[model samples]
Target: MGRGAGAEGSWPKTARAALSGAGGRGDGGGWDVTVGGFWCTARPSGAPPLPERGWQLRVSAAPAAGEAVLSAVVRVLAADPCGFRFAAGQECLSVLDSGTDEPGSTGAFITVHPADDAQFQRLAAELDRATAGLPGPVLPADRPYRAGSRVHYRYGAFAPPAEPGDDGEHRPVPRRPGGERGEDARGRSYRTPGRGRLPFGASGAEAVTAAGATAGATAGPGTAAGSGAAAAAARRRRGGALPAGRYAVTAVVRQCAQGGVFLGREASGGAEVVVKQARAHPAAGRAGADARDALRHEAALLARLAGQGVAPRAVELIEQEDSVFLVQERIAGQPLDGWVAARLRRDDGPGVDWAEAGPVAHGLLDLVERVHAQRLVLRGLSPGNVMVRPDGTLRLVGLGLAVETGRPAGPAGTPGYRAPEHGPGRLAPARSRVADPAVDLYALGGLLFLLATGHDPLLPEDLPRARPVPERLGRWLALAARTGGTARRLAPVVLGLRAEQPRQRWGTARVRAALREDSPGRTDATRPGGNPGTASRSDAAGPSAVPPRPRLGGPRRRPAPAPPAVRRSPSDTTGVSGA
Candidate 1:
């Protein structure tokens, strides 16, 4: 049969009957079975059948044991001899409370989509082998199988291939008697509960209430039907918002081409949460990159960083129609830029208090260092991406652009804060293809400069020219002219981190050491006469103490090369510009 044979109106009666049986409505199709200690549900993709990639197998495991089973399944599939091309979609599975009010256990659902019938059989065989010694019943074909909902992590493509002459427009599916199924904006089919039916595993008073609501809605106008219609209209007005029952969106935090960030409250406990949504195929800079993949990558990274307290805690990932939602604990804080701007507005001096910014700078360094230690680089670190909590600690947000070390450095991160080596500047021609932590260091320098002087280091003209400074600070004096007394002392250290060349940039270790030198209780021991409290006669003269400067680009004598066994110390105390 041709690929388009499975189009909506063209589906054969046999196929429709088979799909109806697989819907898990007790039509004598099949029942859930145990495989390797996990509940397995095998069903049709509900997509128009292509020559290949038409079957889905869902595996459910107890919350405590989900990770282990998921890993085992991945390993087994990776080593499959049949070269089964498949992907796993992950989600949290919850069973509603029964009449007895007994607590139910939460679990994970792994939905696997196989390329074809041959691969599907191979996958089943391999799974059996992987869980051979485990204590569970073997897979059987007699029971009804149902599909899953609210997918969180998608490892590979599960949608059918686009057919020739396809317009990518959504076409509604024919609804069944008790439930509804339809295509989303992106032409992906999804099933949702109808008025009379509750979700799978729902029972007791919940089911009764749902049935009662349905009955009332059908009783005609001037009754409950009028109110039901109003409710349905409200839902349609919500449009692409999250599913209604789980979360109630209160406000929108940010909206971009990629998606929107929403402030919501959980229905279960009324706890505030942040919901970040990613549209199916938003515009992107890199070819083949989409918002879906970025959101999925971020969720995986958040899962890895859980318990570290540096990033927001991931609540759950929900796949609702064409958009994906990532729910996280609401962080109670303001953006770093807003906080700095507020402090600057209140300060009588041109610059902020160094005592306040000093600790913030150290906190940023520590957070970035910990991220790098895990072999990840935060390519999007900027004043906007960092948050200052109520307790005066820092947390890194906007981690969607982060890439692992040694991977190709794509066009990611905010413009001014991005490193020259990673951007499309003259230096990019010779830039390394793989990403590294140096990019983050460059942004760190810019952030610190802003914190100290209330100006961006990238734009030298923004630096204040009225504030007088000692000439000994070198090339950085112009940049630090407006900084506070204590902040001026760290100007060289900040400039060193913002060097144009990656090789010329200061590493985290050197930057930390410089901050320690100017830390509280530390004395300037490098001054002449070993005096910690007094300046030399030359320093007392201020700007006049500086000697006439040599012109740039003039012929200059080169220093002799150092001996092979001897190392030369840096002329600049910051160790960033001396070489």
Candidate 2:
């Protein structure tokens, strides 16, 4: 094994030594080259040393599965920190390129920069252990991309050379049909999955689309959409379910509800957009049409709620070929659960006490109130649906299950946060079909408790043990739970809002008034000379009479910490249940 015959240049002394396997250690500050299969060159010191701030991880996937692979990897990385943790941020990782657009290219490239090198190392080592015994084919040396690139070792190019066969001859190189080279029997470019890059003249997008089609054809019965029967039915109805032209589907994000969510790039502007299509259940007849109609109703509701900041703005609506596509601008923020977890991890101070929960609680309450005022009920409010923007403001999303007030609908909300009256048990023969504002209020209280205590109020058994806070707010909270004095105020309001029966729950006005009262440095609104309570009662009123409340504590001079990044689950992209 030696360097390629074409390696005739002023190679760096260290690199040359490494290629020859001359006394180079793993930790040595020089390049290391592995021969055979596909060449792997490591030049740890060839480029300027990156700062210790973040560790870079390069990922390369075969063109056929590139987009899916990259998406799966991002989901894995963005998941909550369990065995190995990776930070969630816009800078954490990037998709360098999907070989689909390039000629002869058959791979996707991505670079992951973990905020902590040690964590990256642990993750890499764990992955290495997990895939220990998987057998794989050798990669070809002529692949377009080389090991020297950031996507090093992502392909099978890093595999060790094969030993001589028993016949004392190396295995013969596989050939394409017609005895031609660099292509398969199907006339498609030939390359092992995750092998460096595409051939000299392959269309990456075509390969990926073909792969997606193949996958759709073979998708199992339980997935959100796409199967032999569905595709055949779709073909019978039209060439494809979606309308032709306008938006180009880039990748299938995931199946949501009974539908599929696709990532799309607008043809005119090349801007990224999300296309949420109606569910394509295999069941024929009115049931399927009903499902499609439900999605349309959702889209119409979303269009009406656009610009309210409670949901992502609907960009356009396309209804053709018996399919409905709701295109919306992608929301740029972290999930509420992820954000809260990140905040809890970063905060050195005590958990969100009464004062700290004031602003956040009020923000959510006001947002929900706004939606109710618009005559809509967010039937699916949950930590998963809320997104925390970088500016620390919260945006409510996942409006797929939203309905007009008083509308009778199936159970559609996250279970833990659902009001007792809306659960399956209460949906029996005897019940009102009307949706209640108090339902949203119940969810709001649950969210506030989560932010304050980092635990779901309903699931009290698993609550984190109480830690001391700077103020005696914990004691005040406990006292408020029993009897209300001056200090014991927030608990009563929160409890009242979350009461099991909707009739006993506090209204939006009372919740806001309580929040204003609990906020530190503000005189009690019920006291003399305090700002009139009427101002805080209605969000539509001019400027809020209550001063801006500080999070975590009373006002401080320093800018508040930026909200933590949200870790998104695979289903998050589509709000699968609603899509």
Q: Which structure among the candidates has the greatest lDDT?
A: 1
Model 1 C-alpha lDDT versus the unseen true structure: 0.48
- Ten residues in a row with the worst lDDT in model 2? 87-96
lDDT of 2 by residue, 1-579 (tens): 123533322222323442334222323434333322212233322434323222234443322333343334433333312111111111111111111122221122333433343545554444333323221111111121221121322222111233468889874333323444232111112223433233223355443334333233222111122347654553333333233456656666554223456776777898777777653221112122333576677678878877777777778877643346678777656676665665554334323444445556767887898899898888778888787666667677657677788777555567657876677666433343566566777777667656654545543222366432211223323422332222233444545455555655667876676666635323333233644223322221111121223243545555443222233233233322223
Cα lDDT tens digits, model 1, 1-579, are 111322112112222333344334422333222122112333333323322223444343332333445555555443432121211211122120000111111111344665555655566556645544322111111011211111111112244334334577653343233444322211111122233222334564543333333322211011111235554553343342344348776654544334556677897899887777765433333343556677888988888778776788888987764457788777777677666766774344434577688889889899888888888988888877777787888777778877888787765666657886676554454355677777888788778766765654443222545332122223343323333543454564555566565665666766677678734212232233333221321111111111113232335454222211211122211100100
User: What are the TM-scores, per candidate, against the unseen true structure?
Assistant: 0.49, 0.47
lDDT of 1 at 23: 38
Which candidate number has the best TM-score?
1
Cα lDDT, model 2, residue 488? 38
In angstroms, the error of model 2 at 170 is 42
lDDT of 2 at 287: 23
Q: Cα deviation of 356 in candidate 2 (Å)?
A: 7.0
